[model samples]
Target: MTITIYGIKACDTMKKSFVWLDQHKVEWQFHDYKKAGTNKKDLQRWIKAFGWETVINRRGTSWRKLPEDTRASMDASGAISAALQNPSLIKRPIIEGNGILEIGFDPAHWAELF
Candidate 1:
């Protein structure tokens, strides 16, 4: 499968994912949202597959830094808006390939995925 990994370049988990993919001889491309930014369509797709709870990184500093009202008021559209405004609010290292869609960096899960 042709793989594309979406994440911030400097993320520690992203670094590990890079190494894991390399070690497994998986040829992949990086989509650094920090540079290129994520779009509403992609966010919508991921949310549809994994649910908003999985697509959004609620435990991250970016989420924690949001105003209380914003967090409290978050719904599907609100989450999409927040994530579009700040890509860091989305979970790191989302791997998409062919029919595959996954979030987070778990080496064991990745082994099974590939």
Candidate 2:
């Protein structure tokens, strides 16, 4: 199974996830949203698979820093746009296997897959 991990390299959770994958000898590809650029289609797919509430990182400081008006006006498109511009707004460690999607790192959750 091919796995694609989408997140910034600096995230601790992402680092841990990567380590776990490496230790398990899981072959995977890393896509840094900042350098790779997040597209609306992929964001939409993730939102559909995981729900916007699950994929959006509202707990992050980046989300907290957004203006109230901006936050209030965000619909699906707006949220995707925001996520594309500010990748931190996305939940870290979004992983996909083929077309199957998983958000965030929980060893147990991933263990079920392999």
Candidate 3:
């Protein structure tokens, strides 16, 4: 199975996810959002797969730091655009494989993959 995990390298959740994959002997690719930035097309795809509410990391500092107007004024597309421009706002450990995408790191949720 081919997998791609997206997040900042230093993020604890990302680190844990990577370690878990390694421990399971799963082969995967890492997309470091800090360096790579979020892609609009990919974000749109994820949003479609998981829904914007699940894909966007509103709990992160990046989302909190956004200006009141920007955050409050955002429609679905606007929020997605913001997330694409600032990956820190796009949650951690988003794993995709075989056209399936999972957001966040819940070992129970990932157990099926292994």
Give per-model TM-scores.
0.96, 0.93, 0.92
1-114: candidate 2 lDDT, tens digit per residue: 779999989999999999999988888999997788788899999998778778889899999998999888877787898898888899989988876588899999788776
Sorting all predicted structures by TM-score, with the top scorer first, yields 1, 2, 3
Per-residue alpha-carbon lDDT of candidate 1 for residues 1-114, written as tens digits (9 for 90 to 100): 679999999999999999999999998999999999999999999988888888889999999999999999888788899999999999998999888888999988989888
**Count of backbone collisions within predicted model 2:** 0
lDDT of 2: 0.87
lDDT of 3 at 81: 84
lDDT of each: 0.92, 0.87, 0.85
Greater lDDT among 1 and 2 belongs to: 1
Q: Which ranking of candidates, highest lDDT first?
A: 1, 2, 3
User: Of 2 and 3, which scores higher on TM-score?
Assistant: 2
Off by over 4 Å in 3: none
Q: In the order shown, what is each candidate's alpha-carbon RMSD?
A: 0.8, 1.2, 1.2
Summed backbone clashes in each candidate are 0, 0, 0
Error of 3 at 86 (Å): 0.9
The candidate that wins on TM-score is 1
Clash number for candidate 1: 0
TM-score of 2: 0.93
